[model samples]
Target: MPLIPKSHPRAKSLLIREKLVKGFDNGLVAKEGLLAQGRGEAFDYLLGEKTTKSAKKAIRAAAAQILLAERPVISINGNIAALCPKEIVKLSKQTKAKLEVNLFYANKNRKQAIIKILKKSGAKVVLGSNISTSTKLPRIDSARRVVDKNGIFVADVVVVPLEDGDRTIALRKAGKTVITFDLNPLSRTSQTANITIVDNVTRAIDLLIYDSKKLSKKNHSSLRKIVDDFDNKKNLSENILEIRKNLTRGAKIA
Candidate 1:
């Protein structure tokens, strides 16, 4: 990977790309994960590559939801492992959420590689590697359905960053509050999740951790109120409007 200068217009985005490429080379990210990153990058560009006000609201709600959950699990995949492993570990510690390595492109080698990254990043016990203890999530055929019984299988709230649509819907049907990070506000994962942070995961994840810690000082009733006041559909609509505004602003400049 080449050194990205701070003066580069797309320095942060370029750095993220380089990280994913390095991850693929290191066997931490799959080939498909590279394609997924490109798709997300397009949406991030539309979002002005920054966290919006609506995204901050959604992040607060997601933090409240996670804090209020009886069992909260942060699901990990190749992209997430490659992008924000340390932040995820810190979040797990802050919110007492369990870290589980769940992947759409599941395989033994990839699973071990993700687990190793998480462990190195300070995650003590990563789940989703034990086949014997794993159980199927109903109504999903993807390899992501295989969840550890102690982790996502029993979680009341799940934070699935860069998640798939099918698993989000399936998790909702199973009566879990799903919080997801998806840059595409129009994606199924965005629409179906209980709280959708329509921001780049790399940017929004640290905010989630900060919010979780701040909200921790509040009582359960306060946390519940925050979650109750949020509406995912409405927030997504606001995000779409924001995108339109960004495009309009850019058009004027051009």
Candidate 2:
């Protein structure tokens, strides 16, 4: 029957409907977890809200796999460019993955801006599409990216650092291995990925570079293992559980 004090600042984002109250009365244990929202407002969403030992292990495994791989690619988008430019470049250097700019917001100007940032960091680079792009869904088709069926698509592993849904699916269907950095585990992009690293882009990329640089030779089995181990259905199922279980959070704390 008690409630958090009105003075609590985090009360703003709360949307405790009658259903939650009813559940509480029904003896449902208070849910547990970090909220699913963009970073900063919700405890840095990629920090896992309440980062888990499992998520950490997954990230490390992913990094290790990439490090021990012969062919890998790091796909960059505007969000990644804006947030972790240096780290992106560093990982590319370490993994020797081709650095390619792929975005939902496609345009020649945007591509050039991303390229300019990467080139300044002294990283090897490639453009995802042959056509100069300034469009989104129109340019990068839903199931098919006008993306060179040759350049990035040919790589054994593709790291889509920050991505949208359609391209992730498209890349996999095109037969390229896909690794993605996504905070929302339930998202289509995350579930579809060969490796889903649920960590902050800045921190994750740094860890990835550190892991990749430690490798002396490629481990084809390791790469294949991640690809084989990932299960889209299970990932979504677990994430949904986490979301519902944690929905009854305490005083809003970012």
Clashes of each: 0, 5
lDDT of 1 by residue, 1-254 (tens): 89899999999999999999999987889899999899999989888899999999999999999999889999999989998999999999999999998888888998899999999999999998987899999999999889999999999999999999999999999999899999999999999999999999999999998999999999999999999999999999999998999999999999
lDDT of 2 by residue, 45-111 (tens): 3233454544555566677666655677777765565456777887777667677676554566666
> Which ranges in model 1 have alpha carbons more than 4 Å from their true place?
none
Cα RMSD (angstroms) for every candidate in the order listed:
0.8, 11.7
Instruction: Compute the lDDT for candidate 1.
Output: 0.93
Q: Please estimate how well model 2 matches the true structure, expressed as its whole-model Cα lDDT.
A: 0.58
Please identify model 2 stretches exceeding 4 Å from their true place: 1-50, 68-70, 129-144, 215-254
